[model samples]
Target: MTSWILGLTGGIGSGKSAAAAHFSTLGVHTVDADHAARWVVEPGRPALAEIARHFGDEVLQADGQLDRAALRARIFQDPAQRHWLEGLLHPLINQELLANLAGAESPYAILVSPLLIESGQHTMTTRVLVIDAPETVQVQRALQRDQVSEAQIQAILQAQASRDERLRHADDVLTNDRDLNWLQTEVERLHRFYLSLRGGRP
Candidate 1:
């Protein structure tokens, strides 16, 4: 049977996780690309070995895991490095992500990725759902949750598709600049809409 996949995406700190959690509460099977990305870089993974070889051992922590911050800094500063890294990991991550989605038993599945559009993962879905928030809100939220400076956060945003660009690609959009209650309501509404698209009725 064919399952309708929803590509749920948003900029960093745009509350994509929170929106996905609500869908989970409503029984949606959700897969996160970030989790798949990390899985591909586990200590013994071939991808990790290649990354260490190219970027040097400094990109790995003493614990032998990927030093995400250091690696993040390296790739962002060099376009060639960023392109190389994405070329290496995107296939690995996409393979595992598609496998996971195929195994899902739910009537539909949600794939959440910050780079869903940019990484070409959006093509895997029949619908694209974008969780949007103001740039000011994104900056504030990232400052509160991560250790990065405002400048660093700005740099990350620069690397992502512009807010308008993301919206233009979306089949649906949810504004996440408000409180959880408001976000939850939008999620629930979308949840039912997706459920209606399924073969079974709820």
Candidate 2:
């Protein structure tokens, strides 16, 4: 089957996860990049070995698992380190993502990646969907959701592509400023549209 893989992404705290969940409820299987990324670096995985080799033993926790908190602090504090880490992980993540896609049994799949655009993974997707909300809402949601300070949230946002950049690459834009009912309605519409695109009934 010609899988209608859609790249689903948004700025931090833009409700992309909520939007992706709604779409999944409508029969679209969602393959989360973050989850796949984590799987690649699991204990004893080849990716984990490579990571340890490159970044040293400090990136691991006392139990020998990936120290995500320590790694995040390191990356956020240094641009070169962040890029180096992405270079190490992105390819492995994409490989596992493609393997997952190959085994998918759904009408379509939603590839939810926070860095879909910046990481250049959108090129593998049939279309791009962006969840959008005002920056104020993003900041508020980030602070509440991640329990981080405004300064830290701003730094994270600064490292990512701007709202305009996301919109510019979007084939579909789901606004998340409203209630779940509105989001469900949009998902229903998209479900039918996606089926129609593949010559199937809703």
Candidate 3:
């Protein structure tokens, strides 16, 4: 039987990781799309070889691993390149994501992706949980956490769906502007709520 899936998403620095981590501690299996994305492009993977073929060897590091930052910069600068890369990678990433989610032992699993809605992965989920914060908060946290330049962060923000769009599609919203304790409380509350939605199935 398919495990119920909760699609978790948020813009950059919106605390999706922290929320998913808390869910993990509660024995919920979680599959992260970003992790799947990386796995598909690992050294020796067919996707990496294709990437090298398309973008040249410079996109690979001395160790033959993908130079992610270089690829990120290039895709962000060129819409055509970004679309081409996504077309190449998204199917592979989705396949891995579904395989992992299908193998989950928990009653429900969380599929966390920054682009859950935009990428149409939400269709696989039984519920959509959106983590949210003000854009200012998101920018400041991203700057401190990732150390990327503001312009790059702004470009990423522009590339993602707007906050309003995410909210419009959300089945649940967790505002993460406060401390971790508050976040934990909300996660716990939502955990119970999700479990209850299963009608007491163990």
Q: Please name the candidate that would achieve the greatest lDDT relative to the true structure.
A: 3
lDDT scores for all predictions? 0.91, 0.86, 0.92
Highest-TM-score candidate: 3
What would the TM-score be for candidate 1 when compared with the true structure?
0.95
Give TM per candidate.
Answer: 0.95, 0.92, 0.96
Using lDDT as the measure, name the better of candidate 2 and candidate 3: 3
Q: Is candidate 1 or candidate 3 better by lDDT?
A: 3
Write down the worst ten-residue block by lDDT for model 3.
Answer: 193-202
For model 3, the stretches where C-alpha displacement exceeds 4 angstroms are 199-202
lDDT of 3: 0.92
Write the residue-wise lDDT of candidate 1 on 1-202 in tens digits. Answer: 3377899999989999999999988888899999999999999999999999999999999999999989999988998999999999999999999998998778888899999989999988888899999989999999999978998999999889889888988989998988999999999998878878754232
lDDT of 3 at 123: 89
lDDT per residue for candidate 3 within 18-104, as digits (tens), equals 999999999999999999999999988999999999999989999999999999989999999999998999899999999999898
Candidate order by lDDT, decreasing, is: 3, 1, 2
How would you encode candidate 2's per-residue C-alpha lDDT over 73-131 as one tens digit per residue?
A: 78899999899889988999999888887776677888999999999989879888899
